[model samples]
Target: MKHFHMLLAVLTLIIFVCQALPIWMGKTAKRSAMITGASHLIYTLLMLTGLWLFWQLYQVAGVQHWAIAKLVLLVVAVSATIKALRNQAVQPSQAKAGMMIAAVGYVGILYLAMAKPLLG
Candidate 1:
């Protein structure tokens, strides 16, 4: 069950990256970007649900560092999505940089979750 949840989370992350890259690269139109943003939102919700289910089933003690990092990355992703949706104009280079940073943050969270390395 934990593995299943992890898989779902990975899938969600992949979808998010796919949806974000086109916008960040200035390849997607405003309308299409909005649509993709909505899709990402839905995928994120699903991923969270999977994580919740895994926790309930496994009764695993939460990893504080992993959870906090994941939440921070999620917040960045949400903020980027909102900003992208609000502005129809092509994203400026700065916004693209932010998007790339958020992507890296997301990957970091995933790696921390999987690796569970000592934080010291």
Candidate 2:
């Protein structure tokens, strides 16, 4: 399950990069027939797996502060992804900024999940 979850994350990241790069390059990002559907499926799986893992941990340890932090990071990631999807040629900067924010948010979530640090 862990390996599958990790694989999903990597695949999602690859999709994110693929979608953003063209738009960032000032090119029209025409959606491929499968890209949108694949992205949705991948993200759904990734999120579900993450939630299941968190649920298992919660059953044993209750809700940890870091877990809550991770949830917040998830919101950030979703927001950025939405912005990237909505970006147009008029405001390419916003799209790229959103993509960068999402990259950081996803990396942060991965780190938080692995480290599980407590805040003072």
Index of the highest-TM-score prediction: 2
* Candidate 1 residue-wise lDDT, 1-120, digit = tens: 556656766666766676567666776534466657666666676557755764663466545555555666767766765565455255466556666766777778678677866553
Provide the TM-score for each candidate, comma-separated: 0.63, 0.85
Q: Rate the local accuracy (lDDT) of all candidates.
A: 0.63, 0.82
After superposing candidate 2, which stretches have Cα over 4 Å from the reference? Answer: none
The total number of steric clashes, by the backbone 3 Å criterion, in model 1 comes to 0
Tens digits of per-residue lDDT for model 2, 6-64: 89988987887888788778775777769988988988898899788888888998888
CA lDDT, candidate 2, residue 54: 82
In candidate 2, how many Å is residue 10 off?
1.2
Model 2 — which ten-residue stretch has the worst lDDT?
A: 81-90
